[model samples]
Target: MSCVKLLNDFPFTFSREATYQVCEKVETRCSFLDKLGIHLAGIWICECSCGSSDLPLDHLRSDKGWSLPNRLCPCRGPLSILKKQLCSWSEYYEWRGISLDSPVALLLHWPLTMYQAIQLAFGKQLTNETTDELCIHYLGPERELYQTAVFGELHALLPGVRVHIDFVGPEVPHDRDGETISLSSYAHCMEANCSCKTPISTDDSSKITLRFHSGYYHDCYEELTKEFLPDLIIAPNAGIAAYKSWLPTIELIREIEVPTIFSDYCEEACHLAANCITSVTGTPLAIPVQLNPFRHPLAVEDSALLLPCYSNCFLFGI
Candidate 1:
């Protein structure tokens, strides 16, 4: 389907026809991977009072209750019936023989109020601590729907890449039991195995190091640049702002020369507002005009502005 037609027919809310169409497009895309002998795995996402949580939607229903509103989330927030909207693709893919797995990443393309977006973009310029609070707020309960939608589309486009979601906090241990630990411990806490050593597969025979870094640390950006050295960085814009001050993460990113994509769901006004950030920080900005056919209805196609360090790198919204 043409991206224009898909965008026109995009479903903002749940409906049988819309859900089926979206899932059908996903299945068609999965066929591409099948032709390459790549196994398809799906990630199902849903949110509850506990925060953004993931489990197979089918598993949730079978174990908890078929009726969603009555189901009790582990955090004790009654699961909303709307949570089911995020699962249509998973069900459709599984019916078509795709292997469904626990979500590898937590999507963060949450809709932002004009007031909130302005505060976030400008707030970090004023104070560092407020940026951290804003980052946490951006990831709060309200973000579930948009995050789920964009993530679903991203899964459809690159079904072969294994994605994992994690959260990092500010507290740095001077030493582990008084001895310093390597920075990889900060990026991935588990010592036995680390996904950082692995590379995300690309269809073109290129490998990209994708890292989702979230936290309110004074030196997190410096540590990540030194240790992670990711090819691409996908971070919540608000989180970036929160960690931006004192050390100026944006400047650090520019110095390290990695392509970064910031996600915030607002209309044209938001794009203009984000441009203000790019202008002040000296980051080159590009706005994607065409929606990727696989993008979700809630995916802000024209609104997401990409900030890159150089001309060779362009934001490929996934």
Candidate 2:
């Protein structure tokens, strides 16, 4: 299937109610899933700004946000990674209504994974205290450009702190190269009476600001860091081993030592990237390969391999 078809079939902007209505009737009796019908795996449900606060893992897993068979033969393999998440869904979701199966949580995974990587590398220095503003340099953003508004979840996930993300990559649209978007409020539901629609008083507001730079990170590094340096750098599903362009970027990251982290679609990719980084920069990973708790809950289409693959399933640091 074409990538555009996948994007259209699974609109990430749908409201939570609308998403549930679409997936509620899907039967879970089948033991195997066909590629054509796997679009449900990509379903996204943007829960109202606040789905009534957080709930326990047991409750979250028990509820249904999307459909899946009782025993899908393919899921028993790599897809089982979802059941072995590194952190509880509560770490990523502050709401009770969204299920662990929902891909609505996927877009927010970028920020949540950044939060986890920060905690892993810097301990509590950045996140424990609310006084310090955190700046992040995010690399290689494509589809995420369309999902920018969903990133407002970062404000709720990291309360009382200011976050500035500079999205630097060649895929960034030329027209928006230097445009900056400031998010002052959470993404709200379609319902007019949603309580989250209540405007925040000036005294209680915090902003998550994002800027776009259209080019390779290394090519734009000098200008991007001229004013302020990032506390951390993140690249999601970065095919480091596949691209020779990553060599110079890897060297640059080593020189700066800014606690950069990357995630891949699978363990093999993470391992390959780890080796590439070690060979180029003569430096080993600061954070070893491990599963990402906030990874997307759907399987990606891959005909060349027998093992299942999902976006951002594994993470490592350099």
TM-scores for all candidates: the values are 0.36, 0.70
lDDT of 2 by residue, 177-263 (tens): 878877665544434454445543323334578888999989999989876699889998899999998888888888888988899
| Candidate 2 displacement at residue 202 in angstroms | 5.2
Give the C-alpha miss distance for residue 52 in model 1, angstroms: 6.6
Question: lDDT value for candidate 2?
Answer: 0.59
Q: Tell me how many clashing residue pairs each candidate has.
A: 2, 0
RMSD in order of candidates: 16.6, 12.2
Name the TM-score of candidate 2.
Answer: 0.70
Q: Which window of 10 residues has the lowest lDDT sum in candidate 1?
A: 66-75
Which portions of model 1 show Cα errors greater than 4 Å?
1-8, 11-13, 16-214, 236-247, 286-318
**Global CA lDDT computed for model 1:** 0.28
Cα error, residue 164 of model 1, in Å, equals 7.6
- Model 2 residue runs over 4 Å out of place are 1-86, 90-103, 125-131, 202-205
lDDT of each: 0.28, 0.59
